[model samples]
Target: MSQTRSDLRTIQPSARIALLSDIHGTSSDLDLSRLRARRLQQAIEAINGECPDAVLVAGDLTENGDREDLAGIRTRLDLLNAPWYAVPGNHDVGPKAGIADDQPTSIGTAAYEEVMGPSCYTATVGPVRITGLNTSLLGSGLPEESAQWRTVERDAEPLPGPFRILLLHYPLFADHEREEAGSYWSLDPEPRQRLMAAILRADHHLIVSGHLHRPFVREWRGRALIGAPAIAFGLPPNDRSVGWMRLTVGGDGRVTAEERPLAVADEVR
Candidate 1:
C-alpha cells in the first residue's frame, strides 16, 4: 500500500523522523554480544545517515533492563545528527511475571528514568505532536499505572498540530480491530479498554509501536496503526523485515511513513 522509494532524501520532506524499536541491545549470556551489537550498530549508522529531524525509539533498548546494555545503546544513539527520544517497553522495565496481582512493581522504572529519562512524556516534532506511553505497567497494579493513565488522559487532549502521534510499546490489539482485550499480544482487559478509550477520545492520527518484533499496519476508524520490526533479530517467517519506519510530516499536517530495511548482512541472530 506504500509508494516507497529507495531513500529518504528522494522525498520532499518538511520534517523527517526515524522510528526505531526493539533493539534488545544486550544479553546476559555473553555469547550473544557480537550478534546483538552488530545489528544495533548498523541500525544506528543507518539512522544517522538519513539526517532526519529526530529519532524516536519505541522501546526495548536493552535486554532485561541491563544498565550496561542501556549505556551501550545510549552511547550509539548519541552519534545521530538529530535528537533521539524513547518510551519504555516490557523488556526495559516490565514487572516480572510472578508478581502478585495487588503488589507494586520492582521493575526498572527508576533505572529507566535514570538511564533514559521519563518513561512517558510528550514532544512536538515540527507539525507532529508525539505522545509516548509506558505500556509496561499495563497489568502491574503499580500505583504509577494509575498516575500514568491520568497523565495520559491529560496529555492526549487535542493540540493544534497536523499530526497527533501516539507511541507505546504494546499494540492496542495484537490481531484486528475487534479483538478482545486479553489477547496475548497486547495489554490485559482493563488497561486495554482504558487505553483504547483514551486514544479514541483524543484527536489522534496515528499510533506507532514495537513489541511483537514484526512489521504490520492496519487502519481503524480514521487512525493508522503502524508497527516496527525488531533490529536485533527477527521472528522467523513472520518478521523477516528487519528495519525501521521513516516518516515525513509536511507543513500542512500531511504525513507519510515507509519501512526501510537495515543494512546488516545477517537477518537472524
Candidate 2:
C-alpha cells in the first residue's frame, strides 16, 4: 500500500542534503573568477566532509552560463562524493526580456540543457522527493513555460515520501507571500501565487532557494522556506556569509538546516 503523509512522518530519518548556490563560476582567469573558483573548491570540500546523501545546487552555477564556464563548474561539482542536482538561476538561463542589465543575452535553454541536464526535474533522494524548478521561465511567456507548468501540476499530486522539497533559484517572495512582484530579486506575483497553490496541494514541507545572496529562514503556511547563502560571494545588507547550507530531515519529518561558512583564511584576495 502507498504510504500516507502521516505514515511518512514515522519513517526513520534517512537523508542529508548539502545545499549551495550562486557559484558564479567562470572560465576567465581574472582575479574574481579565480577567487570564486577557490571558494567553490573549499565549499565542495566542506560538503564532502559532511558526508551528505546528496547535494542540491540551487542555481547560478556559472558567472554567465558560458558553455565553457558551465562545463568548468560541472567539473568542479563532480568532485563531490554525493550525487548532485541543480536548477538554473537568472545568470545561468538569462533574465526575462525587458530587464535591464549589462550581461550578455540569455544562453538560451538548449545550451544550458546541454550541460546541466534539464532546467526542471524531479528526483527521489532517500526519504525526500525533490522537485527543482526554473524560476527564470516562471512568467517569461516562453514555450517552455507551459511545459514547466504541467510539471508543477504533476508535482502537486501526493507522492510517497517523508518530505517534499521544492528547489528553485529565486524565492517565491522576499518577506511575505503577499509581497509585490516585478522585483529583480524574486519571482513575479502571478506565478508566485500559482506555484504556492500547487505546493499547498502537495503539502510540501520545505522550499529551498538561492539568489538573494543572503541566507534566511521563514515559515509560511506551516512550511519552511529557506534562502541559502551564496557560495561564490556575499551581498551587502544581509548575512553576506560565503558558504552553503546543510539540511537534514529527521525520522519524524522535522527539517533542520545549518549554515557552513567557508573559512575566512581560505578566502584569499
Candidate 3:
C-alpha cells in the first residue's frame, strides 16, 4: 500500500525548528519600546528566510502582557513563513516574586489564554513531537498552576517520534545542570524537580528555555538543555546579542542545535 503524503511527512527523516524567545513587544508602559519589537522584526525576517518547518517561541512575547501588545505580536508572527507555537513567560503570565509589590502582574491565566489559547500544549511537526510547558505557572500559587500540572501529566505520554522537544520559559536553572533549582531565575524548586523528573521519565531529547535573556546550552541526564537569548534585552557581562536558536532533528533520533545571532551593531538592546 502506498503511504499518503501526510504519512510521508509524519515519517520524514529530518525537521528544522526555529526557537524564538522573549519578544517583549512594544508597550507604552515600557521604555525601549522601539528596541524590542523592532529587533524582533529583524529576527522573524531571518527565520522566514531560513524557511524552517516550524517555529517555537519560548515566551515573553509582550513586555506587559497587554492584550494590545499581544495582538500586535500576533499580526507580526502571522507574517512568518512557518507555523509557530509558544508557551507563556513570566512577563506574559504576570507577577514576579520580588517585584510583586511595586509592579504587579497584569495577566493571569485568563488573559494569557484569551490571546494565545492554552498555555501548554503538544504539537507535532513532521517527525518531531514538541511539548510547550507553561513555566509561568511554576510559583504562581494560582489555581491554574494545578491545572497546568494535570495538563503536563496528560501530555507527557510518549508520542511516536524520533525527536521529542520540550519548550519552556524559564531555564531549569540559571547555570550548571546540577545547580540548586531555585535561583531566582528558574522554575521554583518543587516544579523544577517535578518537571525534570517527568522529562527524564519520558526520555525527552531536548529542552529549550528562555528568560535569562542570555544564551547557553548544556547536556544533562542524557538530554540537551538550551537557553535561548532574548530578542528584546539581554543581561550585561554576556554576549547580549539579539538572536535565536535552531534545532535540527535527524533520521536516527539525533538532534543538533546552534545559536544564530542577528547582525546588530549594538548589543545594548
Candidate 4:
C-alpha cells in the first residue's frame, strides 16, 4: 500500500497539485476534534472539486503520533480523489531532541514507516520533481539521519524536471535565513544551513512546509518558501480561517500558487 517513487503515477503536463497541511486529526469525539474533522472533510471535498492531478500533505496529520490517530487521519486522506503524498510533522513523528520533552519521545523511524512508508522519497509529477523529507530525523542523530542526508545529496543530481519542490514539516526559519534558531517554530541553525546548501545545489524552486499553523510566503535566495495554512485551525494575529493551497504548473513550466480558504460553521467553533 506504500506509494513509492516507482508506484507513483506520472502526472500529465500542466499539473494542478493541491497542498494541505496540519490536519491534526484524532479519533476522539470531543467537540474540537469533531470540528477539525469537519474542516478536513470540507477541504477534501474542495480538493476533489478542483480535480488536481496530485496532492501533497505537509504533515501534522494527527494531534498525536498514536497509531489510532495516524490511522484515522490516513483514512480521511484516502478520500482525496487524486494521488497523494505526505511527510511527517513533529506531531506525527514526535519532537526532535531538546524539543517538547514533556511530550512523548521521538517515535523513531520504524514506527512512522509502518504507517507512512519511507520517511524520505522523491516523486515525479510531469515537469516537477517533489522531494519529501523527514525533518524529525534531520538533527535527531538517528541512524536514519545519515540515510536521509544521502537522499538530500542525490536530490541535487540532474533530474528530468525543470522544477523541483522540497516538501517537509518544519519551516527552515521563521523570517529570514540568517535569523537565530532554537526557536520552537523553526529548524535549528546547523541543520538549516546544511539543508539550504543541498537546496542550493539542487536549485529547488519551491519549499513547502507546515507547523507554523499560518500561511505566508517568503523568498530565500530567490527560491519560494511557502508556509501552508493549517487545515485543522489557524493561529492568531492573522486570519484564522482553515484552508489549503492550489499549486498549478503550466505546460510552459510556469508555476503559481493560490490559497483557498474553507469555511467552518460558526456553531462548530
By lDDT, the best candidate is 2
- lDDT ranking, high to low: 2, 4, 3, 1
Question: Measured by TM-score, how close is model 4 to the native structure?
Answer: 0.88
How many Å off is the CA of 229 in candidate 1? 0.8
Model 3 misplaced regions, further than 4 Å: 1-12, 29-31, 95-107, 177-182, 237-239, 265-269
Alpha-carbon shift of residue 4 in model 1 (angstroms): 12
Candidate 2 regions with alpha-carbon error over 4 angstroms: 1-8, 101-107, 237-240, 265-269
Q: What lDDT does model 4 reach? A: 0.78
lDDT of 2 by residue, 1-269 (tens): 11112223454665788999999887665877888988899999999998999899999998778898988898999999998999988888887444665553334566889987888888887777889988888877778888788888887886655588899998999777776756877887899999999998887888999998988877677777888889877777444478998887768766678888887433433
lDDT of 3 by residue, 200-242 (tens): 6666777889898887767777667878888886777465677
Clashes of 4: 0
Q: Global lDDT of each model? A: 0.72, 0.81, 0.74, 0.78
Can you list the residue pairs that collide in candidate 3? none
Best by TM-score: 2
**Cα deviation in Å at residue 41, candidate 4?**
0.7
Q: What range of 10 consecutive residues in model 3 has the weakest lDDT sum?
A: 1-10
Q: Report clash pairs, candidate 4.
A: none
User: Over 4 Å off in model 4, which ranges?
Assistant: 1-12, 102-108, 160-162, 237-239, 267-269
